[model samples]
Target: MIQILVIAILSLIAQLVLPWWSLAIVTFVVCFWRSSSALTAFVYSFLGIAIVWLGYSLWVYGQTDGVFIMRISQLVFKANNAVLPFVGTTILGGLAGGLAGLSGYFVRQVTGNQSMSHTA
Candidate 1:
């Protein structure tokens, strides 16, 4: 469908230009608008990811190198505070776009049938 195609293309663009939250926005949109089946898929996907992340956390909690790497990365990004406003704006914009798309999809669904006019 054209909607899926457009979402996929935008997702790829977001991956290149945005942070991890952009992917979350995509997931939310796909889960919300595509179908109930897609919503279930999203739930299962998150469940699987949670399991994997929990396992990895338990396995790596004692690793010294991971801690050192995390600390260094934190130091490197400490200056992010200076640009927090820009980062916040970018995140909010992506969220707004995703929600707008979802709303448009639902609007089409509701108005698709003349019989559904009352519901709309």
Candidate 2:
């Protein structure tokens, strides 16, 4: 829960000022600092970023009256539906966080610093 909260908040702030890739950095650092296992790191990171992205996309859709995401959806996915783009955005963001989180977890393991060793 803490990992999810930290990653989601940091990722939201990061996205506002930084490039999209900053989500990976936020998730990686959060998991490295708090994750208890590989699965926990990946799942929590995935959920955090996915939730943030989904919410942000919804906000943008509302603000732009769905024009922005709809166009993106058609251009990138050859679809006319907003749902595709929403799901795609969430999944992609989650994937970036999940992979970076796994990397962080493994690096922490290699360094033998299981600071939060309790199971999630």
Candidate 3:
């Protein structure tokens, strides 16, 4: 819960000024600071970013009446389905954040920081 909220809120705010890759940074730092396990870090980070992207994409889809995404869906999928783009966006964001969080967990392990955390 904490990890998800922190990553989602921070990455969302960071994306306004920082680039999209800032999501990676935020997830990495959060996992590095405190995560029970590598899987937990990845799962929490994935959920966090996925939720943000889902909401953001939904809002954009509504605002533009699906014009932008419909064209993208047609181009990429060779069909005009808005759902494809939404799924792609959410999955891509989640994967990026999960991988970054996994990296953080591994790097922290390399630094011998595991002793500080009481893993479940």
Candidate 4:
């Protein structure tokens, strides 16, 4: 239906526009269409995407920067380290990506039943 399409677009927008809590709105909308169970599906989707993002970041950092995570870990114990800001930024980026994934998951879950069905 048109409503589901609109919701899917909005969810994609939430991922594109916001970083953290992107799914906050989309989750509510999906719940309206499905139920709270859809929220769990969204979380799983977010986690799956977040893991991929994290792995990609780690790989890139390893290739270009070398031992970035080790340096970050050391910075965590050392309060005056300069890498703190970099680590903080990385966390924020991850949050954004996670939110986007959450939005995607909810959109799929909400629309799955309607769109995936065979209508004669």
User: Which ranges in model 1 have alpha carbons more than 4 Å from their true place?
Assistant: 1-8, 11-80, 113-120
Across residues 48-94, which tens digit of lDDT does each residue of candidate 2 receive? 99999999999999999999999999999998988999999999989
Show where candidate 2 strays beyond 4 Å: 116-120
Best by lDDT: 3
Q: Distance from true position, residue 83, model 1, in Å?
A: 4.7
lDDT of 4 by residue, 1-120 (tens): 333344345555676678635544654444334333444434433443344344445665668665665566566755545355455554554455445445545565656654542221
Each model's TM-score?
0.29, 0.93, 0.94, 0.35
Question: Quick one: ranking by TM-score, best first?
Answer: 3, 2, 4, 1
Greater TM-score among 1 and 3 belongs to 3
**Overall local distance difference test of candidate 3:** 0.91
Cα displacement (angstroms), candidate 2, residue 90, comes to: 0.5
Candidate 4 C-alpha error for residue 46, in Å: 1.1
Q: Flag regions of model 3 displaced more than 4 Å.
A: 115-120
Local distance difference test, each candidate? 0.44, 0.90, 0.91, 0.48
> Per-residue error at 17 for model 1, in Å?
15
Model 1 C-alpha lDDT per residue in residues 1-120, reported as the tens digit of each score: 333444555555665688734645654555344533423333433433233333334344346535643453457655424233334334454444445454434554565532322210
- How many clashing pairs per prediction, in order? 0, 0, 0, 1
Q: Of the candidates shown, which would achieve the greatest TM-score relative to the real structure?
A: 3
Query: lDDT-based ranking, best first?
Result: 3, 2, 4, 1
